[model samples]
Target: MHGPASSGWLLVALCAVTGAYCLARMRSGAEGQRSAAGGEALMGFGMAAMAVPAAVFTPPSWAWPVYAAVFGAAGVHALWAARAGAHHLHHLVGAAAMVYMSLVMAGSPAHAHGRGGSGVPLLTGALLLYFAGYVLLTGVRLVPVAAVAGGGGPAGWGDRPELARACRLSMGIAMVAMLLTL
Candidate 1:
């Protein structure tokens, strides 16, 4: 049973690590391949962290700034790396969802406990569905290519397959978690 304060710290740590990883990977090469993959993984982890606490425990007032900065950065990065694939859209949507939730949490007076409202759940559910569907679609597309090749295919999946898989699985888990909360 993670309390709101503890959850907020968890989110902060997740975002910080992810942000650092993204920056490091971004500077690694000029092609932006590794950086894009790192960004995708980091975004997945960040989304999972944010979704868990946002769905389980209402965040504190002070946490909103962190959430905003992290998610806003992610959104910008996703848009910047839009050529990666459809997964970029997932990042974009996830970032938008986080920003919206952070704003809502920041404005709410009842930040100590959960917001006992139907609207939050509804919005969360929608965001979860969007990300989950995006993940599933991307996964489905990649699995076949992997299968047809009998191993790592010649497509984009062969290049950074693990990161692609992670993006799909993380988003799927996040979606399930969010739906369970609802």
Candidate 2:
């Protein structure tokens, strides 16, 4: 995100597209999938906004706190939602990471340039490791398993498990890149 404007724009495009897909995923037939999709949608959009190139748009100083507050509330909701499924635990961690990044950005004088605190905080390092592993694990999961005995027709866009996993993987990779910028 701190790199060339082109890279930042790429991040924006990747995240925005992922967010759009997640929004569509909210129409999934499964109620639980819908809930998870909603949370993922929020995270994708938020990351897109945060990764925007500074040359394009620099948020006001107050925006960071607003980001923190919104993500904090999201984290709380994710924690509550985690009771229904373990997947929501990932959402909780993602939300907390966003809140942490927001706070760091808020305290940074050069945040508009995507520079945060003087050095990577321990928490940031931990989060980076988490996301890196998540990306790897999700990547592994995306690989095709054995063919189904009864090959059902392709799933609807909203109900495709592979797509959902891919969405999470993209976000995880994005989170790692963003953290590195910090």
Candidate 3:
């Protein structure tokens, strides 16, 4: 594993901070919509942490299931909370992509599948592109809102809505990095 010396610690810290922030946001009388957006941001951070290091470290086979579980749970949660067409589509594709990656890792010839190939890499790249496109679209939709508000708007540039947009960007970047590694 060629991961950073503090990769594990960094992951833990990111998760904790995001988790705490979400909890605080929820407890602050935030609406379900806002909380859901915050949750997406937290999930994005988690995904970024996992995907980035996993690409670099290429952890052992057993780690695949762990990745699947983490990503699967997040995807499911996002899907459950998704109301808009774009959000639903994003979660659906993300869930499928994570599942595909998990299966590929589990069935690697080294894990005894024998029918080895680079299909997983190609599929992952496609998924990453899809995700990146989705994020770009969503981010574009958010820009006018962020710009018009300029800090004093109903949902400020740094508000939950913007946070969700930021998360999409981070997830898109992480997916791209993961695809490149593949």
Candidate 4:
């Protein structure tokens, strides 16, 4: 994203598309599914917020502290929500990562696309590596190895469990990529 305008725009598209998919799922899903989808949508929204063209404008420094606080609260909520299922716990970790990234950025400018060099904090680097592995594993799982297994028409975004998981992993990748800019 630090390269050309196209790279930034591509990331924006990825975030927007993922957010839209989550919103659509929340709208069409049943009550139980709706809650999880809603959380996913919220995370998608947060990712989109971070993916915006940083060159255009960055939020004020004060905003970053508020962001950190909000994500911190969300992380706690996610932990409580985890009683429903393991996915919620994953959301909890994601929210915590958001809080950490927010606090890190808050200490600096609201928008800094500084990548490279040894300044990468240990925690941030570890998180980045973890998400990178997740994205890779998810992508591998999505490979088309079941052409004749389903034996049906194309499925909706939410119809396939693997697809949903892939979406979540992609969002994680997006979040980590965005954090690398801080």
Best-fitting candidate, scored by lDDT: 2
List ranges where model 3 is wrong by over 4 Å: 1-28, 38-42, 52-60, 77-86, 107-122, 147-160
**What overall lDDT goes with each candidate model?**
0.56, 0.86, 0.54, 0.70
Q: What's each prediction's clash count?
A: 0, 0, 0, 0
Candidate 2 C-alpha lDDT tens digits along 2-105:
55678889889999999999999898776766989988999999999999987678789899999999999999999998898999899999999999988877
Please list all clashing residue pairs in model 3, or write none if there are none.
none
Candidate 4 lDDT tens digits, 1-182: 23245656677788778877887767543454567787787787776675666566567778778877878888888888888788787788788887887776666543444533468778778888877877787788777535221335564544455546667877977876776665
> Candidate 1 residues 1-182, lDDT tens each?
12354544554454455445444444433344465656555654565455544435655667777878888998998887777676577667767776776665576554233366545466766776676776676677666553222245343332444443544454455444433433
Question: In order, what is each prediction's RMSD in angstroms?
Answer: 6.2, 2.6, 5.5, 3.8
Q: What tens-digit string does per-residue lDDT give for candidate 3 at 1-182?
A: 12343554454455445545544445433454454545555554555444444443555778768767877776777677666445655665666666566666555533232234535456666786787777678678767754223246464323465654555565555555444443
- lDDT head-to-head 2 vs 4, winner: 2
Please give the TM-score that candidate 4 achieves against the real structure: 0.79
Q: How big is the positional error of residue 57 in model 4, measured in Å on the Cα after superposition?
A: 0.9
Clashes of 3: 0
Choose 1 or 2, whichever is better by lDDT. Answer: 2
What TM-score would each prediction reach against the true structure? 0.57, 0.90, 0.59, 0.79
